[model samples]
Target: MKKTAQPGIEARKNLDFGLDANTPKYWHSNDPFKTRLHDALQSTFPEGERYFIACVRVFNDRIEDPKLQHEVKEFIHQEAQHGMAHTKYNQLLAQQGMPMKRLLAFHKDKTQKDQKRFSPEFNLALTAAFEHFTALLADAYFSNKETTAGMDPKMKALFAWHAIEEMEHRSVAFNVMKSIAKVGYFKRSCAMVYATWMVMYFMFSFADNMLEADGFSKWQRRKMFFKNLNWMYGYKGILSSFTPSLLRYFKPSFHPEEIPVIHNYPDWVKAYDESGNPHKACEALIAAAH
Candidate 1:
């Protein structure tokens, strides 16, 4: 394969860059509570990366929309970076004393072994639905800072930039699915329901796995899990707004942009050049993590 870097924001049309890798992130790697969270998340980064990998292949095998392909390429570049950064984060966790072997066995390999649980068509549909959900999650992340006061700034910035990009290209996977899978309303609706469950299931599983690693009591882990979720979500306002959109799932006119855009991005994104150039530094996270 002829590999190349993603063009920077000014160089690439339909794309924006939000990475400042030099940003120092604080982690109390020694805290047993924190390390467990790190381990669960370590698996999350790779699993999500694999989803994007599968997506790129979907474009090659299935997508016929040229415009969307360009967007997919942009999405792939950022996602590859997200994976790499997480891989590095995970390695650091392992270095702090959590083995990725068990981590993978639980989260990494489990998400990979998603064969009998769902069909490819269903999976693809769910991927599309979840893409929208992810954008929402990102939007939620950046919309409020009080909930994020003590967060590692590096992770915060990563999620912020990702939220912006997700808002920027939220429709890629859904567009690809309509062009590729040619799925129906019933399948799409079912996929959304399944997508909700799978996301929740995996997220909780990650927390559970982290709890198991801790030498702390079940009650302590339970308290920490809920505390972290609350701290992360802040009155969990994101959920209240996120679910109402599902009613529009099969409504045809419903779209991602109709949901939210982190109070909307700066108007400057509207006037950017669209040359389709790629950027290297951001994409470097992929191989660097490996």
Candidate 2:
């Protein structure tokens, strides 16, 4: 794969949001299924991102490319910010009686166990696979404007900010892996399969738990299930559109740069800044924890 010039990837400190009582229970278009789906993913980030950080950091000394070395540092900072930001969001969910703490604990335990069980190379492979998934989802978010159009403004900005960063550093782990190792196709492919299964499993598990806690009726659950299914797999679904890129991960010679870049990423950054400086948004949370 040829080296393509990438946009600057830096950690913007204090990138926090004002998520308070006003934030709706169903912030994603008032749909329980959609909202819970995002909640599930958010619940995973605190621990999952830390795992990504550790996996990438393990190879930092082995990186010979100066640019990639810097990118790795930026990636670490960005992931740390993401984890902190989402940790705050999960607290907000707990305030809303969403059982976020329990769910997060489950995720944290799983990630810890994986860290203990897996080798550094295997963990790095997992991180690369997971990064690919995030990049694909980021593309989906940007491609489908309606997904953001109906979201609560604060929530939308939060996700948009994350998506933009995800896009910016999508290739960092892949590049690091390629630089340090011989790019084992089998290992990468297997890691992606395992990562995909674990992600889907946890995402749905969290979503289901949230829905049950919200007292969704059987009929409501049935209705929302199909609605979400359609939204995910139907004609205009995000995942449907993402199929091509997702399949590319299976290729022996696949590199993250091979995925097309989001052309209007500058717009995403602007939206995030205008919504609120992430650093400023987290001031209270930072202080309270001290």
Best-fitting candidate, measured by TM-score?
Answer: 2
Q: Of the candidates shown, which would achieve the greatest lDDT relative to the real structure?
A: 2
Worst 10 residues of 2 by lDDT: 281-290
Candidate 2 lDDT, 211-246, residue by residue in tens: 888998768877888877878888768568687888
Give the alpha carbon lDDT tens digit for every residue of 1-290 in model 1: 12123223211223323323432323322344443554464457667667755844654656666766677777677667667656666666555445466756666566666633766766678777777777776545455543344445455444544555666666666766676777677887887887778666765666566556545578887787676554344455445545555555657655555564544344223322222222332222211221
Quote each prediction's TM-score. Answer: 0.71, 0.90
- C-alpha RMSD between model 1 and the true structure: 8.4
* Candidate 2 global Cα RMSD: 5.9
lDDT of 1: 0.55
Q: Please give the CA lDDT of all the candidate structures.
A: 0.55, 0.79
